[model samples]
Target: MTERIWKIGTRGSLLAMTQTRMVQELLAEIGVRSEAVILHTRGDQLKDKPLWKFGGKAVFVTEFEEKILSGEIDMAVHSAKDMPAKTPEGLVIGACLPRENPADVLVVRRGNDFFGGGGKEKRGEKKADPASGPRIGTSSLRREMQLREQFGLENVSPLRGNVPTRLEKLRTGQYDGVILAAAGLARLELDHEPDLVYHSMDAARYLPAAGQGIIAVECRKGGATEALLRHLNDRRTEVELAAERGFMYGIAAGCHEPVAAHAVLGEDGTLRMRVMKYGNGRCRYFSGEAPESRCALLAEELAGQVLAALRPAEEEEDHRTGSRRKDG
Candidate 1:
């Protein structure tokens, strides 16, 4: 009897292909044969514009998703952060691979003294010029807002490209520094660049985007591919992703919303989650913990609280505007 080879769909980018190949290797270890089917997505084609301008992060997954729905592919691998808050109907995340470090990292060019002294400041060291702040490159509004509000960086510029291309830009001194996901740098083994200085952000202070650093395998609900993927799912990662994604959906956040959520499962079977929403030049945060079994509910409750807090401020602003109009 001949064995069947499953087709795993993935984006054409090096990072996407590398992640998909990791899944393929896992399947191979389990005695399942699989092959990578590279698919170029809309996000890949429209590199000149920001993602939100077209269709947000979903643009990256739509083509692979269509192929899966049409039965052209058995499953698709995706960077979990690139997925929308809500899964499309008829498809489900069958597996979430073990997560990598989710913290964001600042990658500074070799000669840039933005940090004053080798990615850190020394006592009495002169700070960089405030009028001409270092040009930091990033594509995410979440990161950009955090950079400005949290770190006081004022010269952030939009940078769009794959991981390697971004690195190339940094190498050429196109920008003084760039912000990138630590997980991607680790996976690509690009973190050891002698010409770059790395400063990792604290995940607690700088919350990661929901589902960041996770590799998700999406398959048709209740399909054979789903069954096969179950073996690869990391239970802890699945639970964490559930809580984080639950909060995202509860808030009705789109892919490009300046929102972040991260869930951690403790050894004591408790799930703790932190969520942040950045807007109007300010940031709102909500955090909660619950038994792992009830993590989803806790996330929903926290999201509701966040929304409730936001409504009063919005209503007050509207009321003041209306009163001024009537008086005029």
Candidate 2:
């Protein structure tokens, strides 16, 4: 006798479907049966408005989660970056897969995948670079501000849609280049195609959007999915993601706030954190190291210091803007 095939709920996007398919294949290899149940989420419907306008980080996960609570789906699969630091009611994130590059990359039109590598995009090879002539598109204010503040590139701005859509925009010259998760391009198997060129960034020089390349497996709290996910969980990724998200969540980072953080395991196995915050046409950074075992505490402390450092100036600017609004 075989167990019933479990159905996993996910957003109905190409990358979402691809990732869910991978999970199903992984389960099949273990002799467990599973299927993908696609759902259209509110965040999926409104691509033009920056996410922060409507609840920030949790917007993408809210609809699917409602179904999980209703028993319409047994589980939900999400990009770890989109999940909030605090668990939603009656739900738990049961697994964090081993992370991919977790670094952001700059992508150009499909014609540039191999300018320097003999047309072979290696494990770390990029699909494009941020050359001066190409107009780069990035959906994140965090990416845009940093690219300008730190990289001196003046053309980057917000562009919406999933991986393929963004790539199409780039291909059509809506942008000479765009920024996307390096992990996303690889996960969808579009990384090595000969027609595209992209540049993966150095994390030390560029702090990545929080939890950029990890996936979160969510299920009803204390449910069977929890028991199953425990098997697929990667312990180190779990700790690192938790700490990075802890920092972002601590500062109450919303889509509009423009924040980024990346936690990496040092050679000594401790967690080293890099954080970024953007406001009023300026960007600032924070860094720290802690024992991986004490990640949560360290993340909280660092988040406070970063925010405190920026808040005073931000508030004064806010006050000035409010005064102008009143005068108008």
Clashing pairs in model 1?
Answer: none
Residue 31 error for model 2, in Å?
A: 2.6
The sequence of per-residue lDDT tens digits that candidate 1 reaches over residues 135-212 is: 788889888877777777867788999999999998898888898999999999999999888888889888889999
TM-score to native of every candidate shown = 0.93, 0.87
Question: Model 1's lDDT to the true fold?
Answer: 0.88
- TM-score of candidate 2 against the unseen true structure: 0.87
After aligning candidate 2 to the native by TM-score, how far in Å is the CA of 145 from where it should be? 0.6
C-alpha-based local distance difference test score of model 2: 0.79
Best model per lDDT: 1
- 295 Cα displacement, candidate 2 (Å): 0.5
**Model 1, residue 280: C-alpha shift (Å):** 4.0
